[model samples]
Target chain A: MIDFKQEQDGAVLYVDDEQNNINSFRSTFRKEFKVYSAINAVEALKNLKSYPDIKVIISDQRMPDVTGVEFFEKIRHIYPNKVRVILTGYSDIKAVIDAINKGQVYRYIDKPWNNDLVRLAIQDAMDLFDTRKNLSDKNESLQSAYNELDKFVYSVSHDLRSPLMSILGIANLAEVDVQDPKSLEYFQTIKGMVDKLDGYIHQIIDHYKGSQGKQFGDRIDFNKVVDEIIESIKYHPSAQGVKFQVNLEQSDSFLSNKMNVKTILSNLISNAFKYQREEETNKFVEVTGTITSEKAEIIVKDNGVGIKEDKKEEVFNMFYRAKQDETGTGLGLFIVSEAIEKLAGSIDLRSTFGKGTEIKLILPGTSE
Target chain B: MSDKLSIVIVDDNEIDLMIGERLLSRVDQSIALTKFNHSTEMLNWLQREDENSFTTNTIFLVDIYMPIFNGYYVAEQITQVFDAFDKKAIIYLVSATIEISDNRKLMLNSRVEGYIGKPVTVSLFKELIKKHG
Candidate 1:
């Protein structure tokens, strides 16, 4: 008896008014399923409460006190995940529909139960229960893993920036006391390298903060975010003679991830400002966007050193630089692409060799 | 106020302390500067301070991250010792990579003037000198 019960695939509760029927169900399917027998509605509730592992329930439709559909409906809220099946000899279509709608029944068994058919139904129900349980369990672990990665990335990037800052500080001091042109140039070269590394670390931090779902739902004010980024870039050397223009049409209620949007816009705008031609009068980056209830469309256009047609495809790849220069870390567009993926959005780029570059992005947002 | 300001620099890292000294010296060669690599030592020095040592023109630059007592603890101890002085020295919090928590603490502590991210630039040092030097 213990061996047969141990071989069972899943636990199920059988509810019927007849003692004879309960005895028969227990005898026939006891080998295949771990059957829990309950004679009346009250006992059925007791069995369900006692055996939390009860996944599928088979209850007779007609009873002395209550109907099977009624019993299933009563405990629907308490045992919401349980797979319910109604059994009855009298075929009542209305009752079966009601059972399916309110009681959330999985299947209907005829008045005279078939041993073979009932066994298959119970097996199928157990399979569905396992699937649902696994899915929810997987979701929890996935979320926690993402959170762990986010914190790890943030701390590591900040740690990397400390030493880089020291080198930068050391460079600043070296620049003042060193009189020779050769040594000054060497310090300038070292400073440039440190600056690039520092910028790369910043991108990593931004990417991690932007990806985590827990960081979402920050109301994005395009004009305000743009204003802040532009204000900051104005102090950088790349802002020289670059006219920054922002034109956004968005309502007050548009909701989206603020950090991702900032990452996307700043990288795009910074790229435009950094790669401009020597002709001072023609340098300008025009940022235009419109936010709707379902999506946001943005265009960043700049008259800068445009990407060559061959290099355009690889521009979004990590560490792929179109221009071999000391100004950029080659991570601006790569970070933008990562943020886009996190937002589940899309981006398009167009550029000519020496004329300019234009980038368009479509991002999802909600007015609520 | 005196013609030359007295600057106090505190950081646990030896290289950072040296760099701070050089940076502040380059800003104004005549300015009197003091450096401390430990927060406890700095606190002990404050305890030994007399009326003439604490002046209105005195400036303190404290590193935020350290070994035993972090920069905020140092700031708290300094406030306890010097908040009532007639010539209160202005304190500025400095960090290699500024953290968000540091910003919140800076806002809460009105004693801290502002946060400066390292490596500190010559222009930034010159700006501080122009303000209170």
Candidate 2:
């Protein structure tokens, strides 16, 4: 599908110790391309240096000082983007074979080559050269853009956090300076606002960290991490009266970024408990999971204050809370959703206003 | 005197440098810290100090991006000057940068002892001191 319609002005250098071989190429390709002849690798290199627009170089396998394979290998380091090809006779079959494999010879033609085929091969090499150059140019631009964004983010975060630090410091000072009860309350509120700002900064940092994918991933015991989280929450005085039950499907060997998954699950489980129904005497949460061939399905069910069906979608949005009584940044569910998405997972919620809420997560498994 | 860890924090913002210094002092009173708002001054001070008597137990807390010279260049100088400081003068990059690659690139430098994200809390500071102290 190469468009040969364009005036192909590029030249091809033909190198051979024998004058007859070089003459054959010159006579064959002189009409279509500007064919340049070289006696050996020395002459070929000289021609290459002089004529930078030489897009392809066809050389004979048998040479006086160096074989075509060795010559191409040396040239590859110097002119890496140049397309190379080897022409060999029946006697130099092994040399040509080695040249093709080791030197990345674009194409090989036997001693007696068809004029049409040789022309076609040169055309193909020119097209390949064009494609590779275009791709390399695009790659360079993309890398520059990536670096610029990285620089901007680094400076922005650093600049933004410095002011936030000043705000928190002033708040800390005011907290001690204020004596009135209502003024103290206002300072406390200011402290809370500063803390929320700190949380947003932390979110930006975490978001940047998560963008790195994972640096280290190993087989982690999910049950151990889950148990530790559960134990930590259970020790909280809030869990004094609530009856807790755990039905864990043993050995949840998931191929995931453990820290991210832990964050996601801990938030979901804790939220389940936090929004418990006031009317229901029995405060309970159920966590369950099943692994399929392609994914791991996890369900966190709680008999707590449930979300109205209309607001189910809103919970995952940033700074979203269902009620005024809730004291949270509302970023937890949003962070959880981001974490789950990173694992190539989907989340769904089922809830009744006063009954309970159930969250289903389907995360990618180790499978082709 | 021997037990105290000498440290320097280089940042552009005065408030951040003060808070960082305060947090470090709160964590451990023994930590004698020198703060610099300009990275150039810090670099010059480091160069001058290296020619003089620079201790082996000193550590640097640097912000990655600064005017004129950045943390990367400062880290490069630290690596060369502190040839014998394999376990000393750890350059812990403290910034709020969200670019993971930037952090990763810094981590590639052996002189960069550790990385702590910005708005570095007292809790994290305590953990860092415990680990490196």
Scoring each candidate complex against the real one, what DockQ results? 0.52, 0.25
lDDT of 1 by residue, A1-368 (tens): 11145465668899999999988888888777788978899998988878777889999888899988888889888887788888877567578887687637888888688887898888888888888788889999999997888678756655677788888888889999899999999999999898777777777677666665455577887888889899889999989777778899986456778888898999998888888888657689999989875788999999888999988889999888867764677777888998898888999999987999999999988444
- Reference-based lDDT, residue A347, model 1: 95
lDDT of 1 by residue, B1-133 (tens): 3445778888887887888888877777777788899988998898898757765677788888888888888888777777667676678888866355547888777778888887767797788888887
Consecutive 10-residue window with the lowest summed lDDT within model 2 chain B: B49-58
Which candidate tops DockQ? Answer: 1
Worst 10 residues of 1 chain A by lDDT: A1-10
Could you give candidate 2's per-residue lDDT for residues A234-269 as a string of tens digits? 865446566776665644455667667777787888
- Give the B-chain TM-score of model 2: 0.85
Candidate 2 regions off by >4 Å?
A: A1-6, A89-103, A214-217, A224-254, A259-263, A266-297, A310-348, A364-368, B1-12, B16-133
Candidate number of the best TM-score: 1
